[model samples]
Target: MVRTPQPGTHSSTDHDPDTPQYEAGAGGWGSLRGVARIFAEARSSPEALRILAGQNKPKGMMCTSCAWAKPAKPHTFEFCENGAKATLWELDQRRADAEFWQSHTLSELRRLHDHDLEKAGRLTDPLRYDPESDRYLPVSWDEAYDEIGRELRALDPTEAVFYSCGHAGLEAAFLFALFARAMGHQNLPQSSNMCHETTSVNLLKYLGSPVGTCTLEDFDHCDAIFFFGQNTGSSSPRFLHVLKDVVDRGGRIVTFNPLRERGLVEFVDPQNLSQMATGRSTPISEEYYQVRPGGDVAVMAGLMKCVLAAEDAGPGTVLDHDFIATETTGYAEAEAAVRAMDWADIEHHSGLTREMIEQAGRIYLSSNRVIGIYGMGLTQHVNGWLNLGMLCNLLLMRGNVGKLGAGVSPVRGHSNVQGQRTVGVGEKSAHMPADKLRELFGIEPPTDDGLNAVHACEALLEGRMKALVTLGGNLVRALPDRTRMEAAWPRLRLTVNIATKPNRSHLVPGQVAYLLPCLGRTDRDVQETGAQAVSMEDSLSNIYGSIGPAKPPGDNVRSEVAIVAGIAKATLPRNPNLRWDDWTADYGRIRDLIAEMFPDDFADFNARMFQPGGFYRGNSARDRVWKTESGRAEFTTPTTLTALGETPDGQDVMTLITLRSNDQFNTTIYGFSDRLRGLEGDRDILLINRDEMSRLGLDEGQPVSLVCAIDDGHERRVDDLKVTPYDIPAGCVGGYYPELNPLVPLGYHERNSQTPAYRGTPVRVVP
Candidate 1:
């Protein structure tokens, strides 16, 4: 007898233990313990250990955690703690095979937490959601593709959304984009839209390109490094070694974040036996400023104001007058805007005194070459583009761009997100021009811009988008307005997921849903030609090869490149111009086509990829060659100083900053413990200032609920959140994302970029 599939539900009252503990520092014995725990839980074998050793090394698989640059001369152990977890998680012995899926009902699987779902192991076969049996049943690859193709062909091309995850390698992403554009639509919503879209959108306006200018080697020559809103320890732990080298060489590091992250304060390299044994740690930040949530704009303006004041006092001592005249434009307006900013307004909005801003300004003035680094903290705001404009203004004041050690660095989350965008996986045709597509492949792609993550969600909810085909990532969980998305998921006609494992996104199935299993970063991808290797691009615009060495658990799983080609072949009408079969068999054909598409960057794609440490895809900004309409860099002046314009009065609201746990990467929860924050066995705890807790008459571990202050008629709330006293700014609170994503309305987003405002969401904490 078939059982009824119950609707999936989430209870806000679910709570784990609220005990928060502490450790000495970020990476010492604690990181080692975390690594050991992950290995033990995975029941890792000696072969798994061999695979871990090859991570981040030359010609080996890149770490799937963050897009941090690989070292030119890598150490014996190039991977970090989180990298180890990601590696082992992919190398797990467990399997969610056909029998395993048959044993568990769809409703029962939906009840499992995201961490538990991942721990259930890698998927071994393609699965089709069986409504009569209320379970996922095994299906052949050809059959699954045929059904998906039929469904896709039946609908308008614009009604289908092709979502690309950051985990996809460059070759796979290229094929994914080629297939989407071949269908004559451009509804490609990617993971970049959520995190660093603002960086791309605003950088194009200011620097003529949407790429960071600095390379990994720039750290060696930098005199000072300024961190705007990134948490190096938790997000990109491997980059901490670069900061340590900077400090060891007499350089300075300045941090501006709302929370005093342990990684930023102190760090002990677990690979260093001397430091690990003695517990002697290297202090990371020379000066740390706890700027308010969404206060980066104010802080950046204040720094520029200080620079202008100093320039006025000394005439031509501070600003780079020559660079401004020859290399840039609109300096007069930018300077006027900075000079007009009120000190009181800057202090009120930034949560930093004038003396503090001046002190930071002094550090900037003293350093000859400065690298400005930031993360999602500056991007996931309503005024995120404005924040980047101000940051660009500050860097331009002293000619920071196109310098050896001075440039903008946005630490990306996914392993190959930037690379995906480089290969034309964006909503717009910025990277893929229509004339080039027509001239090279004789195919004319859609001219109109497509939907992003936010618009995709709205389209799905309103029934405008009929189908969703995801390459990877838990899209349902990663996006904001979770309550609405979860409720409206059933409205779609079809959903197809190409992934390595099961997650919440697969649980919320559409009418015709298919879970197509694919090879992971650690799984060997042997194509028709031979053992295949995929390429990836780091945040610094360096492209390298990644060849997985581990064996696959089953032969049913296919390579992402092959899977994308299979769908394309089954769906699109056969054309003599396209060679889908050859491209699937040999990825070199794809690379050759990519070279033809982006000749300037990928002229010798395959050959350059074989070089040691890979080839740099040279940024125009780094070469001092601005490609703007005016043929020079431009300065921008923001109209507002506050990130999220003035909050309403008489509302007991705190700006809630969504954070990721040290044990987590993006939406994939590694474990319940966040050792750096001294939190264990819980992911539903809120971090607030002690004074704010006292003011609310709440004690540590007190259960409370958060309600969005926006009166959008939607009761966006998360209840039963344990309040823990923390060192965050008074008016700011911190909590993990996806759990609190429900409070972030779909309508509330950056105006120009459309990136969700996940960083500075105002919410009222009620007991």
Candidate 2:
């Protein structure tokens, strides 16, 4: 029987000693101090310094923080503040070894905060949950593997789900896919499923390819850049350099977000000695529009409507008719849809007047080359795919895509999220064709559609999924409806987590849970073929090599490739055709297989990896060669302008946007402070507009509870949340993820992509 997670039972109530202080800009002395504080907390070692020096460099490991593109000629100090925190966090000397596990029982560990769990340091050994003792006891690698294999083999292939994290390298991802296929199931749910699955689903329909068409060089030539829902500073701070370059070169940047993100407002590059010395910063967005949460579709449609209106005023002069006629389909339908939308409906939904929308459209019309960049904000909504489709429609109106300095760029999070998808770590086996699998590895993959994150969770709760093998990531914490997930987590028969550090997910153990310690990106991975370097594909499909130089924290810690291979060898029947041993011996063999599987993208895999900035797996859409069924880019007409459905009668609700702190990376909480947002030492706080706070009869620093508006019978609420007034749109509130994830119902997700609507979760505040 599952017990309901009581509200405020595990919430963070203690506030920081200092009051919340909003900084003027992002990535200045504050960023430096934040980084310094983390380093100090980690008790900076020589190994840490070495790892920091090599981060994002050509010869060093890629920053495991975010999937921001790296330059060909990298800067001396290539990493950003968050990147540094991610690196040092991995290189922390403190070890959660046998003693640590013995001292802390599962119940005791569950009581600790997410940040405290992370600070417990690296896992030094393979651990199996001892139910009798209510603790995790260290076990031998072979013993753990044998037990896992026995459990997995006993369960139906369809009952097991393999979850892959984006932080893994291409080699590991490729092997993971091969393992899953070999095991006769395609139940591969990945980190991408939660964040940018909408980008993939929508882009594939519109542009044939599921990746961004633009490269890093596009920022240089782009005359205008439009940012929708992406906070460049906190999510991907390194991108600030690219935006700054555009701003410095007389480019126009238009931003549309609920909050006035400091990064979008202004950025101070820490690398720029002169600017740092003078406390000077480069202004980023020329125009910032604080659109209401879940109103992106309306805002986007209004922009297209304005563009269409302009085209009507002077046909051919405004729109690229020749390109549309030649390179695209369904333009007529898209145009008609935009023209039919009423301005009042658009304004009421978007919380922006006609003049504001037209002004932004005018900027778009004036610019010869434009780049549309967005993040999870645009993708994690009920109408996420529609939001992206509308953005694509706007770009197509002016023929911005398939040209230099122009295209839709989805700023993907995680280091190798794109790479994992590229290598076929997905629920579908379309990338890993059935015939190809049969021919290459003599494996018969499942024909039926596999489970995504949402489905996997449902399966777990319903006792359909027996086992879950995660490569990395805090799966439980990253998901929506934290209370339900927490309750449903133990329903699984077996849970295997291949991880480096401790997190809250590890606490929610299954009936038989095993924690397999794996090598971090910063740790040296020495195989039979000597020190190995893994490759990662960035947000723009740029593949680069990452070689870790630091020694592994423990002798027991193994490479992800090795751990995955071990599981494969243990679970699946012995096949002469599949060389799991050889692949683990030399990851280059895995890359070789990937090259064979994806010849176009990863041809000459090992050789090209050594190149200075790596290689770009060119997008067909970028070259004006569409791979869609119609053999041309297609324009998608949004079905409706109502993004987050109609609010219930007599219910005063605010759309909630889950955010990552400046000191955090994904679910890894480095510290409580979100320096850029002027937040400190608190994670259970909500950022509401001053006017909205007053309307709700709420005061700053007042404790409040959030009740999810979704009528799922079960109450979804998180209590003891502090309300802090912020510069966000009214009828919208912002809170850190994992904490507020409880308020986002699991059933409340995007219709098309099924990505959780983490950004625009409708909820009501109560005393």
Candidate 3:
């Protein structure tokens, strides 16, 4: 069923349009290699100049996340193709603002195509699109803040929801959570819900902690790395540096993914001295296997079965029987279930050979320290929690749970989500109660549970919720069932979004919609008191200060904390006796309150954050003691093995999985198309399997339509879209999210985690 790219798909002169044209560069192994080489060269370049460089910087401002963000002398070519595209994403280009809004009403703006609307570029002013006037009007910050404060003050604290994006920093998030708690609210919906909700839930159950158990420094000491459903070379190019070190040191790296990506095959390390000089690419994966999209749990169970069998056969130095019996529960049950499964069924369902699975198991048995790294690919499945649970099972069996360089790591999307959860931004759970809240903050917090991302959408649609105030993120577009979300916007009493530029969420007109342009991560935030440095919590739960080198975009744009404080001042008047003005003057005062409230983690937040490297929120999982009732890791039993949904009953329909392109982040579309995929200047093309297309009576360049059977049961067909049939598995298709999010059903989500099961959706094709 493997459909590799066709041969002879590239021409020698791809850039020269005057050369004889051929379908040669359409799709093939050669085309894939060419794209990979282009990206590698860009990554290795020393002079990593952004393609969209302009008059903004003093000549040294590069992407902070890119490899070129360091202080070393820049290489000749350092920025990747995607990094250049990301630079274009943040260029000082202007999208039509008050003037364009004046010409078109909110209703008319809603009629424009997604690509066409994005082409309008960045927004410059605070705007309020008026439905009656059929135009967007410029609104003052004072008026907008006043309207938002009044609406928030009117609602019961539980009714208001605060959602965050991946790009937000710890300082802004801390201030946002404080605002909610000050107002006696706890409804916090964030991007973590959609990405790694399962990892947090499952890891907490088994390891007594939610964050990653290992740090980047631990990669140096590891003997084996189980890369479960993560594409390191693409998602985080910096990971290639770590993997290259592992291979150079004779460590084995195993990968379990449906697609054998080129980045994993061989990566030319741009940072390595000898590799960069010689243009030598180091192979990452010693053994790679294609595990079926949702079959990770089953494959992991099989591996655990092999481990237990080996332990029973003979006493070995690798297996720690004493630790297993003392620290973990239900090992015998897990072993029985795994041993009961037939090898044939496991292979058939997992789409992996037994030989390949055995190789992964052998690596685990021989390695002194094993680290499991996973990304959204593992957590976005139907049984994502179970997948994470199995990884914990593997680590627990080998006594690798508590030790350094041996633990589960779920790479996150956002910079500060882990910190936001620490600063009192979550729903009511068993561990976090109202009594604890009263003891910490000196005030009784709300006892009721709040709405999550999914529940917020449902509440908005049912008219149970009246107001929506976003700290940072695109709610309408980021959520599944985009059509219903767009329609639900008008039902709100007020909608306030604090963002950097124009996004699709702004187009969703509320009765009173307000957009407050704010300072970006790279911009300096100056207040009446002085210049301030914001903090960000990294993937390892470490809080560090972030001070931008560049000046603010405009004088009118406010800092996120300032806007939050303004709303708080307007909504909850500072009592002369209680006094809140001092807290707003210095952010350290806020941190002091946070440290007192969460003493277990942030014990000297002010002193620690001032330090150069910042501080780490010490996690007890380093000892491998479960905080659960059992006091040890417990294996969960599933009520149902199969996901409850409409199965493909020989209708020739394929499951569609939408993803973010290399150029784009979450909701921000950096460019029109993905260049690495050989997709030219268009974003609407559907990448299909060549064999599957032929079977469906469709041609390569034919036009087709897609109807969303899941969301609102409406026709979501897009016509005249060119179909580029290429290498894809049968009964499977892929496309970009948000643009194709309307196809996902609202109720289709992971069981325990409430994360959308975006990878597996049954859809029929029309031509």
Question: What number of clashing residue pairs does each candidate have, in the order they appear?
Answer: 1, 1, 14
Pairs in clash, predicted candidate 2: 21-678
Instruction: List the candidates' TM-scores in order.
Output: 0.96, 0.96, 0.86
Q: Relative to the true structure, how large is the alpha-carbon lDDT of every model?
A: 0.86, 0.86, 0.63
RMSD of each: 6.4, 5.0, 6.2
lDDT per residue for candidate 3 within 540-639, as digits (tens), equals 6666655554445455777777777777777764644223456556667667766766678778877776443346677677666677568887665432
Q: Which regions of candidate 2 deviate over 4 angstroms?
A: 1-21
Over 329-430, each residue of candidate 1 has an lDDT whose tens digit, in order, gives 988998888888898878777777788888889999999898999999999999898888888888888999999999999999999999999999988977
- Per-residue lDDT tens digits of candidate 2, residues 1-767? 00111111111112222335454578889888988899988877977877788788787889998999988988888899888999999988899998899888889988888888889989999999999898899999999989999999998899999999899999999989888888878899999988999988879989999999999988899999999988888899889988998999999999988777789888888888998898888888888887777778888898998787887798779999889999999989988888899988787778777777888888998999999999998999888878888899999888999999999899999989989989989888795878878889887777888899999988877889999999999999899888988898888899999999998989989999999999999999998989899999999889999999888989999999999989888988989988878988998888888998998998999989967777988999999999888999999887887567545544376778899888788888888888777877788888876666777788889999988877869899889999887766666788988788888878889888889999988788887
Off by over 4 Å in 3: 1-88, 91-124, 273-278, 315-318, 429-442, 573-580, 610-614, 637-648, 707-722
In angstroms, give how far residue 476 of model 1 lies from its true place.
0.3
Q: For candidate 1, list the clashing residue pairs, or say none.
A: 21-678
**TM-score of candidate 2 against the unseen true structure:** 0.96
Could you tell me the lDDT of residue 363 within candidate 1?
Answer: 93
